[model samples]
Target: MKKTSLAGACLLALSLMMGSGAALAKTPPDQLIIGMNMNNLLTLDPAAMTGNEVVGIVVNLYDSLVELDANQLTNVKPALAKSWDISPDGKVLTFHLRDNVRFHSGNPLTAEDVVWSMRRILHLNLAQASVWKSYGFSKKNIDQQVSAPDAYTVQITLPKANDPQLVIYSLAALGNLGVLDSKTVQRHERDKDWGNHWLTTNEAGSGPFILETWQAKDVLRMKRNPDYWRGEAKMNRVVLRHFQESQTLRLMIEKGDLDIASNMAISDINALRKDPQLTVDAVQRGTMYYVAMSMKEAHFANPKVREAVRYLIDYQGINKALMPGYGVLHQRPIKAGMPSTLPDPGYTFDLARAKKLLAEAGYPDGFDTTLRVLSDQPYLNIAIAVQSTLMQAGINAKIITGTGNQVYGAMRERKFDILVGRGGSGMEPHPHSSLRALVYNPDNSDAAKLTNFQGWRTGFYDKQLNEMIDSALLERDAQKQIADYQAIQIRYDQLIPAMIPISQMVDSVVVRNEVQAYQPHPSATTFLRDVWKVDEGDKG
Candidate 1:
């Protein structure tokens, strides 16, 4: 147990040390400072970012070929490409770009630039490169690659006809695959350094804003692009101020210092809802919060022990305590009714049955286990509720908490008996991304290496999942796709890799009344490109 530097302390510490809303005075609206509760932001490079903090900023500073729109369901217009056509087989895609789209460096965006940007992804094996596999891609799936048929048309062809969504996913995977100028990459390569120099901190994106300055671990500043590909951003400039204090964030929100704030405490969320000055809204998130048992802990390998642990969790109580009416209890890792929630009966909860099962497994008196949680406030409530519930069922649970990276690293190393985390699907809610990242082991499969969080890899499940994704691609029949999904979901239930889904927590955004046209997607970062401030003089 080591004390965290002030820069790393999240909202929970701020809520205790400083009164809620105290940090607001430190930042004001003329300043437009935004608060980030999560601490893990490493690099602005599209290839290096993993967590939401850095990605959130990247989303605003760069424009992708497509973006999730207001409805949060579909990718719409205003991407680098004005329009796109999908081939009959849903494999080949042709994008028609807008003319005169200029990068921040005053270079015109061309079809060749798109090719260079995407090809670079393949060449680099970037952190998010695995996401491209859905498009019939591996290390070498871009057979034909992106080609500039003309100045305004970029044609891309893949080897196989897979998901139509793949066309959009590839662009959305990174900072909108922010169009890279061909000359820029070539210059970097000539310099023997590649696009690493400029693409790292400074971007040549065609988005509404351009990166003005990035002070590592401190702040990121951007100015509205005058010659933006789409149109000008409403704000003159945006300053993303990084503060670890949750109180600082809430204060900023209350004092009109910050126009938008996220990752607020449950209590703060409830209180904010009562204020007319701000909007407290929630959407059904694609994220599923659950706990996974580490195989490294021998006792966790026992089915009875795992089931007992699952039963002892009071998910409903924890969710209610965290943010009343803000979440929906998840029956499976996926949300029910989502085309991908994947129905399974193993997600149900029963305390008595769990105790009985534990007894049958030779733990009638219950068992002692260690549970790890994140510094996020909601997780704290979950930890406490789970501890009390498990104790009643004859189990002793010790709770461990730390920063997100610390917890994630420990989980990857299999250092804890049980670890809690939230898994989110893409904007489309496709199961392939979550399934591969959490269940299928990349080491054993033909797929690229991904994060199999719970170590749930098994030959049977792995084979079945691949077959299901592949079957969906081969068959045009709706019924066949349904059947494949059912079979996969049933097998996943039998495996029970991670048990006890708490709920789906949506990405809630709080915006000022003066700010209009803000759009947020469950999967997309909270920054809204369509949103603009309604000027007092322009009030209709």
Candidate 2:
């Protein structure tokens, strides 16, 4: 036998490696691997979801009656509902379901599923129940609120007249409104669990993907739904590997082992922009990071003190220094891009003004206080900056940093003095979504503790503001409704509630060159249905 040359020997080794699946493992054409920090993911059940990380995953597994337009976050587009009609009184909404949609378990989508899914939200009293409860839905009345008029018709009746647009948005937007496969979910129900325990790790959705495996703090894998109503996904599988550090994600993407890095630090994203093989996208999400002062605390009970806290924030300074490419200075409960959002009103870093306000509020020397913040980047840094500035105004703030649950739990329980956190209501470009959550708190009773209502949680309530929110919901005229929202926002600004909107949150993601049509949702959700990968030679 002739002695094999070095090149021949190398070719033989390469063939053997390829045969062993090493080549396919490097960058599978049919699979998309994502690296992101998913430690915050508490549940996959849409009703209990409280974080964006889970929404990014749930949106692919489930379909809503209506969806935010991919190109425009504000515009509502058809999803499971093909068309809808509003009653003359504006208290009833009727949606005509799309035909032939099937769940992952081969159950046909129908109006009954829609009705059951919505009623389950109220019955379970999950995180999303507060939104519906505000609209007069309750465990006792949910059956009356939602009804299936026919196999393909879903009719929802509000307890009172409301803006039909907002009503539709509340049911169709992201969050808990994703219709579940009723029969399949109910079959797995044990002791009235409402499939909550089962759905935490499994999915019965009809969206573009099916949940294959979900090992918390380990990995989440989803396979393309071949029977998807819209059509099959381009990729065969999508994997979200748990990666807490941004550096590990950077290395994964650089090595061609990951298709997308969803949660990268600002510094890493900026550096990745220079790499030819990676694309860095910094998009504004429908979110705001701000400081909340609990009215339960006597030190923050005065409106003057709350107003002073607004002026004490170094918004522009913090955005430019600590939040570069991650935040934009934004002031107002409603996010900037949405309809009816008021102008900034120019709350700047005015130490003297804050000091004067503090004096007028009977804290002439300023009082020592505690500021709670999540022990995470941006939150902790923002809290530190605010702490430094407040100290100058004689307000000695002791920063208390903890996990999101620890800090936000205190706020929910009305126990924190000041909290630096992020929140957004309607990622659908609707003002009601934000206003209803950030301003309206009709019931403050411990028995009626609407913890999901951020305003109620912060102990901020004004009967006038509540009435305005209700009136805004009742107004049917688009222009008049917008004007009403504007008025409500003006009142909120004057009242100086516990919250002071600081900056709009921005998120960045790095994707490899092989990926295409990767549009980031303004809500910071990841829609992987239309995402496809191309071969190196297929690159344009």
TM-score of each: 0.84, 0.91
The Cα error of candidate 2 at residue 149, in Å, is 2.2
| Predicted candidate 1 versus true structure: per-residue lDDT over 1-540, tens digit per residue | 222555345545545545643443433222345556545666666655676666777777666677665464444545777788988976678888878788777888888778777777666666656566545565565536667899888888775666666456646544536666668556656364447666666665666778788876567788777877557766767777765555566766776667777766656666677777778656666666776776556777777777777777766666656646446666565455546456445444588888898888888887788888987766777777777787888788798899876887776555677767766454454555455445554244324223443434212235665566567545556566656656666766666555456776666666666566666555555564555565434665
User: What is the Cα-based TM-score of model 2?
Assistant: 0.91
CA RMSD per model (angstroms): 4.7, 6.7
The weakest ten consecutive residues by lDDT in model 2 span 1-10
Candidate 2 global lDDT: 0.84
RMSD of 2: 6.7
Cα lDDT of candidate 1 equals: 0.64
Global fold similarity of model 1 (TM-score): 0.84
Best by TM-score: 2
